[model samples]
Target: MNASLLLSITPYFPRPISSRRQCPLTVRRNARLQSPLCLASSSAPIATRETEIELENRKFELLRAVTDIQRGLTATPDQRSSIEESLVGVETFDAGKPIELDLLDGTWRLQYTSAPDVLILFQSAATLPFFEVDQIFQKFECRDQSGQGVVRNVVRWSIPRLLEEQEGATLIVSAKFSVVSVRNIYLEFEEIAIQNINISEELQALIAPALLPRSFFSLQILQFIRSFKAQLPVRSSQRQSVGGLYYLSYLDKNMLLGRAVGGGGVFVFTRAQPFI
Candidate 1:
């Protein structure tokens, strides 16, 4: 990504997540790992069949409210507070470590986020008529039972005059995450990559299609646009790097709510396909 695009998109996780404090919340739980120390094996009563139904209904209501808010981009102060309260209410039933839940091992489409960094992109999309922000997705892939995983944050966008809607490129941020506690996860970003460029046919024919697949360069075309495909390091120093903390406040098979450790704001997501 070039400096301008990076300036607009890089803050998706510019700062490391801090795992300092824990918020009071709860949430309904289902699915369990086969371990003696796992919360699922506890003696506490699990959600009754009736309670499970109620939780599902409540999730549907919250989903509808979030949709109306346009993912928090257009939410009023009162509306944002109301949504936050509803999220907390639903989080009350959350039990056990969500990172250990099998339901979390998949892609979750970002439905809402109050994070200032992400909100900036939403604001930019509204003001810049030519620039468009498409779906934002987070995919988690765990390698073992150690509660460690890889998290990829994908932002799909396009410039209307330069690229087609479906042919827009993606800005991917790759990070390594580990379950720090019952509801907390620490993310250490590895690198950032900008890829999957699709130029219009007219432009492709004008330029060599061979190099267009990955990158393009020519003396004939001095270039009006700046394009890049490279992986850049995120950490400046490994020793002093503490990383960022993501608090998984509430999670279930369908719905998820997470709060950034240092007032980065809340994030709401729903399970989605494995790939974009």
Candidate 2:
């Protein structure tokens, strides 16, 4: 009877299965056993590992781009405007008060205000290394309250400066400004003089020669104000403080021009703000 059953099953078995197993009965029974489960589990882990690797690679690429920009700053001294354009994802914070910056190149000018009131001018080749306590010196042109021509000053301390200098010594090729006025012209119960100064067309034409370039002038003004506000402190009392104008100017080829403008105190807002 067993021989007869084997013959019957042999006809039903596939040729390859029968050849590999050599016994039809054994082959039929083994086909009902569970498939290998480990393969499925292993495949899942492999796929997950691949995904993680891809994500890590993406992060590395982003970091490399930042490093490239920083490296460019230290490598060479480049034009400030060119440097600003190259910093694709750079971030800015406050150090003390706001200051205005005006970058001038020939007849092209860019003006902007910064919140921290500290502007760093770096070449496109300098690498921004991570560190604590970055010492920054501010250099920009400004007009005193008397409206006499533009004078340059160097700012060394403020909330914005403290924050940036504490860690992450970055080189910035930009400008800054402050909102609060520094001069105290108002006397106790004294009437202030209101004078409307107008310039004739001939004078305006003559003054144009002293003006900075027009292209970067607006940009410089805006940048300066933004940086200055980041560093400026809010005072409780509203008093008529001394106000001045700050801007940036540079020479491209042989022409002179204006870059930016800010109306406020040049560098009188922060004395007690903490550094970051």
Candidate 3:
């Protein structure tokens, strides 16, 4: 990410998560962890069969609302507020609960994000000479203490040189993250360092043109990926660090729904294969 991109990031996290380990929110699980480090417990009332059923139905409604919002490009202020309220009000998980390590760990691929930058990633798909398909995603691992861990956002791409008849190259732009706060329902990530990006021959070939006039993902713009990928060893001492407070509304073994604070947007995610 560059200065411009950093500037564009809205104040998505209204409150910075505590540096200290605090009581996390809540989670739902049918199983328990036998490890000394993990447990399925909560201060929230243990759901009875009826409660579980009701929770399931509410989740269904929220999911449906999420889908409807995603389909519409025009999201009213009320609609956005409703989305956030719905998410925060969701009882899919328990509150004032012990942090469940199992809930927090794993790779989470983005199903939806309200951020325009994310939308740009999708819109720019046509610029690559190779076919470009990717989803913005992140992964984290909670440590032994319920406190903190590392997080990585991977912009994985399946870029194929279809015109050249060569195999599509797998391109990845990874951003390193530090967990600032680890609330059960929320997370704060600050980019620490960006690995050097060695532009591949295939990628170079794809974007060798002088430029595409007035385009979002022209060869010139795509080079941001290179700068961000370069100089991995140096950590960013940001005048402003890019990060967000994610408000998790729903979570289960297979799915997650979260909305960034400040009405930035809602997101849907599923467990990715090849979990980190």
Candidate 4:
């Protein structure tokens, strides 16, 4: 029998070592065992190894399924169902206590999401001629050794009429996240701001040649844009009712899965370069 199968039926408690003579053939024939006579001690490691392999296979399938979904903007209903199924499979083997894992501290690139707000942005970018959306990232920085951290969702977008192709705007949604449970966190919205407007080289070169050098133009524009930040007000609270619940369904060295509580939506992310 397979080790994993043996583990399922094996006796939880170790049976006392017995000589064949101690267990008479007539007595053994009259008794029926609820579980296998074998002990489960050796099967534990085999079961764990099997689970790890299954998780890896599930993750690979999920990544492949979402490869062409364009962050879920173009995913059909059938495709969505398939992806959801795969997500559940991977989630079954989630880290027991993701908040306690140091692997959670890093920037993660958004590979796919079913959140309405994010999908709306993708739809808008596809339909609007002037507005375009780029990469999205979520950065986490834990602190105070309390399993608390700041989570920032960064969105890069551009307006073709106002900025060059390479120039873009960054929208940062800042929130404070606290571990409310082993796999759940409470996110309190803190602020939303648009910052870091990158001016393309072509535009800087063209405008700078006429009046000042490129470096001077770049510096002044950056200074002007730096003033465009604001501190938004937020209600203070640590209660789950005060904010939204984010369930970390899966997390590993390379990928992560975040599902909004109450079936709001799901987000899939892969580890990326740290945020500056």
Candidate 5:
């Protein structure tokens, strides 16, 4: 996030070629004059090919540099603050409201509902964080009032966070959609239900080691459990209606707490003075 790091990494992007062109024939003639004719002819083609390859490589390098810069900006607090300030004049929508979209089968669409100024700021803020936009699809069948089933509709929309390195070394984020049906809706909802999927071994290897330390992992699990507990609302109906009872039962069955409880025995009753 430091400015120095940005500057140090900037060289990875290749600079544009100067507009001034070199005369190939003249260079060939000059080479022939200094070297044997046969040698010059053989080296000329090789030199041209090498130059072409170098240029192509430089272009790719430039693209990667640009992408890195944008990605870095996404994680920077200053950039986020700037974007929020820019959007101050624009109307903001509730974060929880579902954004409406329309789609066609086998196609993706990107739409923006925010004001132009707000959009500009949003894009500026997100420019570095995303890589590409794509469309995902599914099929569904529905029945009309007549109770006859029909292959009803197709959906389309853009997917944010899809990265593309080949095209201009840039990242993009966009919204996407698909068909409307019970199955499709269920699948989409299922995705939302289990959005916190754990990283696979292969993916973990790609992540920075610092980000996945043992302490961090432990803290994450603790935080998850704490949030889960906090979300269990208290019901006034009955003790059985509260999720905490079930949670306590589960803890006392399979966990260390359960073992401790098992080690404790019930108290003995004394009846010596009961008659008096």
Candidate 6:
């Protein structure tokens, strides 16, 4: 199972261990298990088992779908487009359960996406993100708003900084973004902006070139929004968003699969515990 955790395109996905166990047979046979006076309906156990089986089956199917795309990551554009379409079509993973907004808080690393074009100029690499990505991630925090409100951001990851000699080096370009958004099928937000950016010697060295340019990496990447280039903002004098919507199709404790509304992109992400 640990090995399967690396099933996504980034070559590393974190999967949860199966801790879902059914009640003991004897306990199920008893009319009351947890409460003396409260009795479980006869069909409860069977329904639960069926639900478990359905979830397990869906998990396996998603794993296979992810693997298929990851394998085709390096294929031709037409082929990759086909694969991406198929990947989006396999969005049966989410059980339509309510998302625990609290659990959504944390750092998440991008692994795969079906909708790359909506937010970028060039196509992403089939194997890796089309950039010298030291690391790409987004962080979410609960906004002091009502339920399902969050402040989402995409922050770190630098440009090419002479890899070999740099020992415990600093980040060059960090896109610090913070935007209030609603947490639902699509992390919908209207006003999107860079918020702020911290530059370093690497970007300084390339002072002649465009700093924090869209084409440099991916346009969608800069917004640091949740999921794909979700809710593509219309010619943003404000900032880049998305043409379609972003759907967090699948999410476990460790793995996340984000898809674009309509038929476009799906991004895979793995949960990363923030450094202490």
The model with the greatest TM-score is: 4
Q: Of 2 and 6, which scores higher on TM-score? A: 6
Candidate 6 residue spans exceeding 4 A from truth:
1-43, 68-72, 75-96, 117-131, 143-235, 238-244, 262-264
Name the weakest run of 10 consecutive residues (lDDT summed) in model 3.
162-171
Q: Rate residue 235 of model 5 by lDDT.
A: 38
Model 3 Cα lDDT, one tens digit per residue, 1-276 = 333343366255555765786533321221223332322332123324446666666666656666644322345677666665665655336543444556757888775566665555555665655555445566766646445565666664544533212212223333333333433333344443333344555656566644545356665655675555432332336644455566555667666765567766667677887533
Q: Write the per-residue lDDT of candidate 6 for residues 5-90, one digit (tens) a residue.
A: 32232244465765886577855766454555333453355456666676666555545555534423434677556545544444
lDDT per model vs. reference: 0.75, 0.30, 0.53, 0.80, 0.28, 0.47
In Å, residue 61's CA in model 5 sits off its true spot by 1.4
**lDDT of candidate 4 over 78-155, digit per residue (tens):** 999999999998887765855654778889999999999899999999999989999999998884457788889998
Candidate 4: residue pairs that collide: none
Ranking by TM-score: 4, 1, 3, 6, 2, 5
Every model's TM-score: 0.72, 0.22, 0.51, 0.74, 0.19, 0.46
Which is the leading candidate under lDDT?
4
Tens-digit lDDT track of model 1 for 3-26: 344336434545466586434331
Pairs with steric clashes in candidate 3:
26-94, 196-229, 197-229
Over 4 Å off in model 3, which ranges? 1-47, 68-86, 89-93, 126-131, 158-244
Q: Determine the C-alpha RMSD for candidate 5 after optimal superposition of all C-alphas.
A: 28.0
Report per-prediction Cα RMSD to one decimal. Answer: 19.3, 25.1, 19.7, 6.8, 28.0, 14.6
Model 1 C-alpha lDDT versus the unseen true structure: 0.75
Off by over 4 Å in 1: 1-47, 96-98, 205-228, 236-242
